[model samples]
Target: MANKGPSFGLSRQIQDKINSKYDPELELILVEWITRQCSSDVGKPEPGKMEFQAWLKDGCVLSELINSLFPGEKPLKKTQSSSMAFKQMEKISQFLSAAEKYGVTKTDMFQTVDLWEAKDLAAVQRTLSALGSLAVTKDEGTYNGDPTWFFKKAQENKRDFTEDQMKAGKNVIGLQMGSNRGASQGGMSYGRQRQIL
Candidate 1:
């Protein structure tokens, strides 16, 4: 017997967009993460072999990814109150608008949202993540230090510690250096030190 579920694969356009926007390393991570989230099997598909259906059972995988990438953005929650529903609708509107700006259509987003309505928190998250991913483009770079990035920026600003610099004994801020006393002065003192002959 054949598999009954919808075929898994990304449209050529979406695939192209993803490839262009994300670096190869980041793409691999995304693929791996998605696979881990969606698949029941322990082994994951190769990066090149990843398909939309592989990790997108509903949209939860995408939602989790979005949450991780954009810590400031909150996913829509399932609500019973009418007022909360209104607020959720407003957030959805904003997301759809943003997605439109990035080439995704309101219809496309609505379909995903509708399919996952009244489902668990994971479903809501996945729907939002799908929308968020659609809205991202190459022009808008990712947030700094987001773990989504596979290749991180080079540490060019790192300063090497010299013998004199180490000997200077610069006090670190917010770090407790001595005994664990309740109110002991642990901060670095900026004043000059006196030496006894």
Candidate 2:
């Protein structure tokens, strides 16, 4: 007997949920990404429920894609100190909140925490990466359909002002009055009085 061709479509419920959560353009991008990442067969059709579920379970592809998008940035690392553990928990909480907004269940997120509890750093990293991927989907409509908006925003927020830069800014502000010391007619000089008519 000839082998039957692999099934090619997602279930209606899952498809509907995805559609509701993502815009059509974003959905297309996600479908293409999934097809590229999960399919081994040449000329394979779009991923079906089994393929989608398997991809979610494996998570390596999702993790790789996210890591590639954010080069030189690893947000999830093994916690060595108490402060690091606190920070990791805060990050996990944020991820859970974002994932919930994108329709991921708490139970699914708890599995990631379980990996952390087990001291499987690799697994936790992969899980956090997968969650990051899913969180991008929630940015579709609100962020002009750019999936990397959150990541970019997070990067911007992480940037800290250097002490030298802060001191330079203060110096600039302090020198403003000195710079205007000689200008009294057009530009007001410091401590100058305007006569009342």
Candidate 3:
């Protein structure tokens, strides 16, 4: 990627394959969700990979999106836009860390270069999807977009049993626990004869 010159042959193929993973439908969903969350300030991007990448490359909008989900004080301090590569990457890193603290797990997080360099835009989409799912699941009233927009994650279900019920359940054996009622070893023999002690 350092060489901005035109790619060729295998490299071009690889790049195209990577870019192909970008989902246009996912782009529209993410764009609409972001615009709703960030209010009218964050303009909508044209429905395309490059357009989506351009809209969020600087990371300022992402910081705003995540901040808007918070109740009181925002996680990020400064989300000012910058024209430099390192600065942009720094902002992206900050947003990523803030998102992590905001409840997105490390496994669900995307890398800075994934957005900055357009290396894996699908990864960006995945991270946003995870954030949306989390926000919807939390349902703390801070999330701005429509609840249906993001699929709500399932919550843990705990069940408690009374002492009598637990004892009765333990006393009975399930069918899955195989029985030794039949004499299965009657005619079974292999590998040399067994010796009597």
Candidate 4:
């Protein structure tokens, strides 16, 4: 049977945007992080086969890639820190908190929120195409050094997401989902969006 699922791709348009917006070193770091995470979670042949460098930097791909490399493990719990590190550490802590609330991880792929409500696969596909799916790997919070920390953050903030908020969330997830799909689209296509069981 033909496998119908979302796939990832590297588009010239996106790559051009990233090249223009970010420094080459930053770009390489982001790409390497994403490629490594995708390669790791998807269990592909090798990291070199994962072409994340050519990806566009329009959405949260950079953040997601970073998260993938450095995950926050025990996300549900919070830690008390001194005021001395407040200026430097607050931002990082907040991001970890947010990611934990979302259960951030590379392998945690997204599905339609209404998947159970859809009567048929095609309907699900339509929803997925409109909203897009995401691979919730690493994000800003991953740098916290513990995947569980981010996971706990995800658990905490799971309810704060509204419908519109969820739609926006899909953009980043879609990119990761695309990576999992591989280069199936070839140069002609950047990614694929389809429903699956």
Candidate 5:
């Protein structure tokens, strides 16, 4: 995109559509969540698209947010701010890695370019939403924000069955499987006429 210059015609419209997907309400929720988790030192972003982008562009706030979520030892060593493009990107990457280590699955994590380039802020919001949900679900007491900010993700409930139970269940068929009883191919099938070889 750097070499492609400005967006034009259909491309510009597509870009606008993508940008429109950014939700201000979710942004406020995320901003408040961050403010609560990391403290007032990180500062708040003005509620707008570019401001949100610029706030997280450096990734220092993000690194601090992830570190704050940790119980004791921080996954990120330092939350350094840098003006250099590569350094800024590196900080975002480190934040992402630390996030993954803190139980954010790869699917829930956003890429460095997503926040830095502002290509897909909605994706960034989704990542943050997932993070909030995870933190709420874990309930480890490290989470600092309001508990209602994000809904808790469903936890895994594993059930074990003994061999006797399994064997007894094998004879029973659930309604979901649908019964074949009292039914037969009494006539031609529905889809197509029977074809002769």
Candidate 6:
């Protein structure tokens, strides 16, 4: 396929309504804020920061600017339950505490695991090996060196893997040597050979 436009279609009337609600300059700033939120390049930011960010893109306070820009328009009413807000706030507090203790931010949680800027392939390999070793050791199994498994587990735990002592789990006769003969004859056996070599 060649390309399509935005996922959401905006009717001309709706676009006009939105445009009339804010000044062009202010709208541009909000666009910038939204753009940053959608951008993968943006680093870790505090929760709820995006809301204020959209407000601050033009270096203007939200309440003042919104009122000035849309004097006649009513702000969108959000009827959130108090309990939900409390729970969310509590969770945020806990996360902040944990992040402070660990010297990591909530943004770092995604940034660190999903993407890393290592110096070279050697460094990346070293990191991946460290993760693989940790996975097998933590579970008391032989290291299978499955990047997919390691990546999934690490993402789930929200922690990178690193270990000095790790072992591969011992294979049982049932699956390792019995019905799954193809697996035994295929890359599994070849991998075993490589390990020995």
Using lDDT as the measure, the top candidate is: 5
- Pairs that clash in candidate 6: 141-169, 142-167, 142-168, 142-169, 143-168
State model 6's lDDT. Answer: 0.32
The lDDT for every candidate, in the order shown, is 0.42, 0.42, 0.88, 0.33, 0.89, 0.32
Off by over 4 Å in 1: 1-29, 32-52, 78-197
Per-residue lDDT over 1-197 for candidate 1, one digit per residue giving the tens place of the 0 to 100 score: 13345324575555455335333454455555544443443244444423333433333444343433333554434312233434444444544454455444444454333322421223333344444344243324433222443333233478799988786766444465565668866686669686779
Tens digit per residue, CA lDDT, model 5, 32-144: 98998999999998889889989999989999999988899988887878889898999999888888887888987888888989888988998889889889999999898
Q: Report model 2's TM-score to 2 decimal places.
A: 0.26
Candidate 4: regions farther than 4 A off: 1-19, 41-197
lDDT of 4: 0.33
Q: 80 in model 3: Cα distance from truth in Å? A: 1.8
Badly placed stretches (over 4 Å) of model 6 are 1-82, 103-197
The residue pairs found clashing in candidate 5 are: none
lDDT of 1 at 104: 45
Model 5 residue 95 CA deviation (Å) reads 1.1
Residue 50 lDDT in model 6?
Answer: 31
lDDT-better candidate, 1 vs 3: 3
Ranking by TM-score: 3, 5, 2, 1, 4, 6
Q: Once model 2 is optimally superposed onto the true structure by TM-score, how far is the C-alpha of residue 142 displaced, in angstroms? A: 20
**lDDT of candidate 3 over 10-110, digit per residue (tens):** 99999889888888888888999999889889899888888899999998899998898788999988888899888888889988988888888898888
Model 1 has a clash total of 3
Off by over 4 Å in 2: 1-28, 34-46, 75-197
Pairing residues by index, what is the TM-score of model 5? 0.85
C-alpha RMSD of each candidate structure in angstroms: 19.5, 16.1, 3.3, 25.0, 3.9, 21.7
